[model samples]
Target: MSSKAYRVALSASGAALGAIAAYWALLAARQGHILFDTRKLPVVALSGDFSTYSHTVPGGMVRGYVYHPHGEAALQDLFVYFAGRGEDVRATAKALHWLPEGFGFAAVNYRGMADSEGHPSEIASVADAVQLANHLRKAFPHARLHVVGRSLGSGVAIQLVAQQKFSSLQLITPYDSMLEVAKKRFPLVPLSLLLRHQFNSLAHCIGVAAKTQVLLAERDDVVLPERSAKLIAAWPTPVSVRTIAGSDHHSIIGFEETWLLLVDFALTAVLAMPEAV
Candidate 1:
């Protein structure tokens, strides 16, 4: 209870606050580089069902590409995909060969990734993805839109769903909150306070109008199976969860077990269809 000690502690706290404010100011001035790493990834536009282009899209232009079968049913809604951290559209396209033939897919480089412009190296760029999805839905009024996200992408997708009403939502290896993920990444940081971007999906899960498909990579090292299970616990039943058996985080894309589960989930989980009149 020494008055001298209390004064020193108070002074130190003020200095800490000043330093944090300065660091955050530097981050704020740097616009879209939130997620863009500037490392170019291979973009393969398929002859029939897939095409790649760097377009200026809603919420700032981004580098993105689309994929579909040569004769895919145009009636089917589009799949707007979000990829994992330190990853881009190339991973999904390459994994396409592993997937069944049906549906269309678009994987975008969020603002600041690869050839994408703007300033981003964090999940704040997810706001841009949400805007892009809304624009896509409005642009293709006829095509019912669906959004799918993987790994770190699940956080981006959750934000989009919270903001936009989509046909369906697919989340793979999703964490409960960005705070949970930040804590996993940085045990030293006081995750509750230090984390600025909390894409708290659980808080908004009830607002999701879209029927969801939860895909958990079995034995996943990157994102534990428990995380997906936890999210599904409160979600609607008939709310399906598919386990990519014998698959891990990095290998899920290529594993036969993973693709089989996805094929069933993708083909079966159509968003909006009329029931009995």
Candidate 2:
């Protein structure tokens, strides 16, 4: 081939590679935006009084509310809660009524959500959870620590349980990983290569030693039932699975049976390890 012909061929190849690179970059950005919807949801008014809780992370502060049982119960057990992606956790204070007596609740608002600061990413959110869990451990040295995570927060809880010792871990409508969910939603996108926030809870479950309980929605539209089943099967530790009949993703938490299962599991776990409390 002539030199001019060779140069033209090289230029064509460069252009093709450039187009592929640009497409990958765009896909990554789009996936990140959709995965981490940081826009704050409207806070609902909470019915009960709650104490302010804050933890300083690398970039900013993670703040939320702490709820105690009505009377002097000595706060024997503590539940560190991570709410769903769209959840306005300030309202979680009102849900403290569902918890058994002698249990304290700490609901953490993810960074960039509500009054919390910094951008929301899977790494940052998990780091914030670690900081908050560490703080709670020190604050309630005598209390047995338990974790409850719903939806996106379940990913965070899985990571936390892998790192810290929790009396019990409860996951509500969780997925195997954000990447798997993204792949299901946007099949055309190369999620394995372009996805940034792959919150792989299934991988994290391998190291979790807590008494794990998973609550599944019968008709979960957000996290498909198969993904939850995969996570359950992949768990190395024994996990209790409970499906709420006729409940969807958002409405399952509203069911009284949901809270009853959580309360019973936590109580049973705490009671089993009475020395921890």
Q: Using Cα atoms with residue i matched to residue i, what is each candidate's TM-score against the true structure?
A: 0.73, 0.86
- Give the C-alpha miss distance for residue 237 in model 2, angstroms: 1.9
Please, what are the lDDT tens digits per residue for candidate 1 over residues 197-222?
56677776766766778877778755
Q: Give the Cα lDDT of each candidate.
A: 0.64, 0.81
What's the true lDDT of residue 240 in model 1?
A: 73
Task: Give the range of the ten consecutive residues with the poorest summed lDDT in model 1.
Answer: 268-277
Find the candidate with the highest lDDT and give its number. 2
The list of candidate 2 runs beyond 4 A from truth reads 1-27, 30-33, 71-73
Residue 238, model 2, lDDT: 87
lDDT of 2 by residue, 146-183 (tens): 89999998999999899988899999999999888777
Worst 10 residues of 2 by lDDT: 29-38
TM-score of 2: 0.86
Superposition-based RMSD of candidate 1 using all C-alpha atoms, in angstroms: 5.4
